[model samples]
Target: MSMKLITAIIKPFKLEDVREALAESGITGLTVTEVKGFGRQKGHTELYRGAEYVVDFLPKVKIEVVVAEDAVETSLEAIAKAARTGKIGDGKIFVTSVEQVIRIRTGESGESAV
Candidate 1:
């Protein structure tokens, strides 16, 4: 069976919204990692103890979801909608084909393994 892996980098504040949206869209599981990076916006400056400096890495949430081929677009749409903030650092979504998936405990493969 064909599968797709979706990795979304979103603002940390939007994690809950994205999680709820994914669940409502029939996505049962996913992995999340707290990350930091910069894009076209580069980075930002803030005041720390009355001192101002530029922070190069912005905190973000990385969400990884693997699903059946048929669910790819719907899942992407859901994530985009829920994570959107109309801002420059809203982050990105990446999609690629997954060659295989295995659930060791159940020995299930393909979509079942997902």
Candidate 2:
């Protein structure tokens, strides 16, 4: 079966809720990283018009999970539900196909690598 990698950029504070939701959806492992980025809203600031404006660097959390194709939709829904705060700067999610996976310790493949 094919596999997929789901990467979601969400507000830092919602990480815990996302983790819990994933676990509840039967996802056992994931990776999280702190990140900063800009989106459609672009950058905003307030100060002297003539001076150089420093763009605000918003704090975000990147969550990565690998799962079987069949599980992708559920995992995505779990993350979306858990991360949604109905506010700005919530971030985004991206999904991509994974060709292969290897476990460094045991050399496991397929779902085992997940």
Candidate 3:
């Protein structure tokens, strides 16, 4: 079976919603990381100690999930619907082919490993 890696960069506040959505869609495991970056939304200004400063990199959450190819579309829909805020900086979803997967503990490979 073919596999894919779905990476989504989303607003920090929406992490829980995305996780719940993925779970409801039958996605059992995923990895999340705290990240910072800027896109078309560019960044924003913030006040700190009464001083206004430009925040070039906004806080974001990166979610990485590996699933069977057949599950890709459902996973994408789940993520998109859950992550979208109808505004800028809601985030991006990237899909890439996964050549292989291995379960280190059991030495299982391919679809089963996933």
User: Where does candidate 3 have its weakest 10-residue lDDT segment?
Assistant: 37-46
TM-score to native of every candidate shown? 0.96, 0.88, 0.97
Ranking by lDDT: 3, 1, 2
Estimate, for each residue in 46-103, the C-alpha lDDT of model 3 and write its tens digit.
Answer: 9999999999999999999999989999999999999999999999999999998999
Per residue, candidate 2 scores C-alpha lDDT tens digits across 11-51 of 89999999999999999899999988778656667568678
Model 1 agreement with the true structure over 1-114: per-residue lDDT tens digits: 699999999999999999999999999899999999999989999999999999999999999999898999999999999999998999999999999899999999888899
lDDT (0-100) at residue 79 of candidate 1? 98
- Once fitted onto the true fold, the runs of candidate 1 whose alpha carbons sit more than 4 angstroms away are none
Estimate candidate 3's alpha-carbon lDDT, on a 0 to 1 scale: 0.97
Instruction: For each candidate in the order shown, give its overall lDDT on alpha carbons.
Output: 0.95, 0.90, 0.97
Pick out the ten consecutive residues of candidate 1 with the lowest summed lDDT. 105-114
Clash number for every model? Answer: 0, 0, 0
